[model samples]
Target: MDPYLLNAPWVNTLRLVLEVAATVAFALSGVMAAARKRLDAVGVCVVAFVAAFGGGTLRDLLLDQRPFFWIRHTEFVWGILALCIGAMLFMRQRHFEPTERAMLLPDAIGLGLFAAVGVDIATAIGMPPIISVMMGVTTGVFGGVLRDVLCNEVPQAFSDHRPYALCAFAGGWADVALRQVQAPDWAPLVACVVLTAGLRGLAVWRNWELPAWRV
Candidate 1:
């Protein structure tokens, strides 16, 4: 990977944009889950915060980075809080049913955006391709895992049997491959997001599932 390509100012801007979008997408998914559970306002906010920040927080910890991402960008905290309040009010006023199906779109989008951001960051830090891919998967999937655990259900990533994390894994590899070939600086990120989200959306629409273990 050419270090200069990833370090460009516009590429940095793109990464920041991806991170913000991913945060909002995951936060919305958390809101839907809380609503589906008929939780109170505080519960809604808590779940939203966890879903928004959990994965990135874990990644930062493992990377030994100072000042967790959200801490470094305190506005993320306020944004999620505002999103929670607005989502709750809008859902209630519109009599919207926050079904599981309703949550899938945002979850898939967040997975893709987070996966791209993760791979880019890891690659920029000179991590090996395998490690970068794992970081992407972690950043994409762990927050939803934490969300489901908080909601008192087995994580859908593990239990749904759909191609959730697999999408991220494939996209991560795509990102790495593109960088290896010296594709345009933005190509990896765009390819990662599109391929990951497209695969996940297709899986959900087609009701595709991985084989479950037999006892």
Candidate 2:
């Protein structure tokens, strides 16, 4: 089966849909972070843009795609810019708070989407399974890692509290295994998204963590 279902007449349509879903979720999360930092308009745009493009850009770079998604998907860039503006205006009206809580959902969703796509794209280019897995994990977590650095917070994925990257890594490997099973293309995609989202949700709900790194 073709890795992309919409590699059909509706390919562009599906791409637009996936791109928008990931873009909006990531843009909002980044905007929320910038709001907490009391960033100005430019800072808000920068943060939102980085968050929105971070995962995809990293995926493209690793895949050796020149120009990146943001370059080709100019509308995606504009959409995040608009969203950042709106979110900043809205934050001005309410007492917006920054909690680890807000980032969880978007991060999880983005992780699933990015991870699945990373594998698909890598596989399309004939990358080995292990490389695809690495690309998937990198595409999933590197954004939030960069986001934390920008926000001056210790990266949550690398820390004990949430273990977000660990969840993503497990899911990406699961995704690769699923594909190698030759079940269906959708099998890997569905499994990747479900496993990542489910694990992230569990971590958030139960406050799960890896055992404390040695004292």
Candidate 3:
């Protein structure tokens, strides 16, 4: 067994909490995308499942891990299903419209949590630093990218130019640095979450964007 995978009960508890938070956040973002597209209940569940598991599925594949997360933990799928159903019911009852801005916070939070978890998983598998960081970015952004594509919009991670993946990259490096400094297991996760989400939120609030390139 990998030493990194072995931890105290409280550490496992924290990891579970972070995982649930990230899953719920990404699932909500997917639900919002479905709402914006006026998707039916089936479409909503599909989008939410993709958004919640897409990145982690890819990460597990790249890591060559067995029992993909959703398969290993059936609850994740059930949770997304329940979330989509409830969100759809609530929105329908209230006749509420979901805006792009409404998606931002959840997206940011998901990005941060996924990024941190990605790095942790990669390092646990003894991957190199650069590869681990890249994995972190992939785990953070790919779900949202898939969601946007399914929604028939340009992926915000690519087109919005608001430093989305870059935020994840920075957070990944921060996680690595904290680990190098022998920080507690929870510290790196907390730092990564804060940095990634904070940077994303600030970018949106300040209208910060990368300059568009002329062809």
Candidate 4:
């Protein structure tokens, strides 16, 4: 039973659209980041792939979706490749930007979409609500975290005062509550996407951060 289809079909179509936009943004950001790092053509693509798909890969594994979403969506792979090549060929090659300001927008989009999709898959697999929410957050952050580690830096999302992953968690769990109420399936998905993107953008704009432990 396509559990995520509880909403009207139009909602599903909207989600599919949002998901694609998010994926493309993520791919572009990842590809751009790799290029800025001065990675060779091959390294540029490998890093891009890891940054874009790592979270989804982990989420699918946890959900027991063998073969993974990227494997199933082979065009997604081709799209990533096309993006990498285009970025390399056309974009100005620059030294890696540590602050990485441009990445903020795309990363937020990626966070929202991945979190929503994670919730959908988890609910489909009959996982407990809380676990599903955690998976949602994981789906949003793991990719960038791993990408940062590979690039030999602590993830900006974690090291900074900004509420990066926190936003993802909030967005993910929001859907869980909605799921319990049996509200339109797309409500949570749309809510999470808007919330995650807005929260992250607000945090960046306002310099918002979690309260630090006063030792």
Candidate 5:
């Protein structure tokens, strides 16, 4: 694949799509968390916005990108707000249970999507591979960290003893590896998303856990 293709308009469009999807995923996770905590509508909206934008905002700041991603993409703001309202109404109408278990899928999805976007953006800016990977990890994990803190719980990325950030880390490497070999522009992104989310879902299904540190 031509290196220039990475910056092609279609690639940018795909990145925007991934970002939008990831935002929606994390926003839903926040909505579920707020609902589980029995927060009011304003609280729900706040949490959802935080979960949706927290990681990406931090990524933008670290990259020294002005205006932040949400600020530049105002529709994303409106969309998340509408999503919060619709999600709340739908859950209430359906008597949906907003359990921790219910939040995992969307959280995993957001993690993968954000990780890919973070890595790609960093790489485009000519960051070293390790730095790009770390950016991916940061983008993947930070949002949920903020969400859990707001909910007065330990961030599951640390406490769950499952491979949350680890999944993102590995997915980041997979992306870097693909780019090294000049794979198709979209291949790295897809591989990162699938590997990260698939690993997370598998870990949940298998009840896999990393060994806990003993005092």
Candidate 6:
């Protein structure tokens, strides 16, 4: 039996917690975007649902996992619905305007958390380290991509180029390295989350950007 599988119970718990956190953060991001676009209630819910589950759905499909996470945990759907309703009500009451800059923090947080979860899942499934890292990047950025595309904007992962996927790649490798060294299972997850989020935050704060290619 794989040691990763042996540590399943606790690891699974951590995964669940991380998944919820990621889902909420991404959902908020989507809601903010929808609000900025002046979308109606139903549109807000649609965007929130896609942002919350898009990446995980793609990840599970690639891994051949049945009954995608959101499907298995139907409560997540209700949670997102409640969250959207509450957030909209609050924003309207306060006359709050959702700005692009305001969306960065939650989006970054979700990216980090989902990246860590992706690496964890792929590792547990006995994927190679490189593949696990790729999975991490994919899980981190895919939802944001879907959200942006739906909003008719270029995805941040493609256009912003402020070390988004690069951060996830680095963090995923860190997680894999820690696991290889017999670190506690939770350590890798925590470390990766911090690294990915911290890097993303720093990138935003410092106006970091990949050099643009000119024709």
Cα TM-score per model: 0.92, 0.88, 0.92, 0.87, 0.91, 0.91
Answer with 1 or 4, whichever has the higher TM-score.
1
Ranking by lDDT: 5, 1, 3, 6, 4, 2
lDDT, each prediction? 0.88, 0.75, 0.86, 0.78, 0.89, 0.86
Which model, 2 or 4, shows the larger TM-score? 2
Two-way TM-score contest, 1 vs 5, winner: 1
Backbone clashes in model 1, listed as residue pairs: none
lDDT of 2 by residue, 34-148 (tens): 7777888987888788877787788887678888888886887777877877777777788767676666787687778777777767876878888888888877777767777
- Candidate 6, residue 24: the lDDT equals 93
Indicate which candidate wins on lDDT: 5
Worst 10 residues of 6 by lDDT: 1-10
Give the range of the ten consecutive residues with the poorest summed lDDT in model 4.
91-100
Worst 10-residue stretch by lDDT in candidate 3? 1-10
Model 2: ten consecutive residues of lowest lDDT: 6-15
Q: What TM-score does model 1 achieve against the real structure?
A: 0.92
| Per-residue lDDT over 43-138 for candidate 5, one digit per residue giving the tens place of the 0 to 100 score | 899998988898878888899978888889898889998999999889878988767786778778888999999999899888999999999998
Give the better candidate number (2 or 6) by TM-score: 6
> Per-residue lDDT of 1-215 in model 6, one digit per residue for the tens?
35765567976887898899889988988898788778899989988898888887888889987888888899999999999999999997898877778777877778889999888889879999998988898898888788888888888679876888888888888988998998866788898999998998898899888998997
Q: Report residue 102 deviation for candidate 6 (angstroms).
A: 3.6
* Model 4 steric clash pairs: none
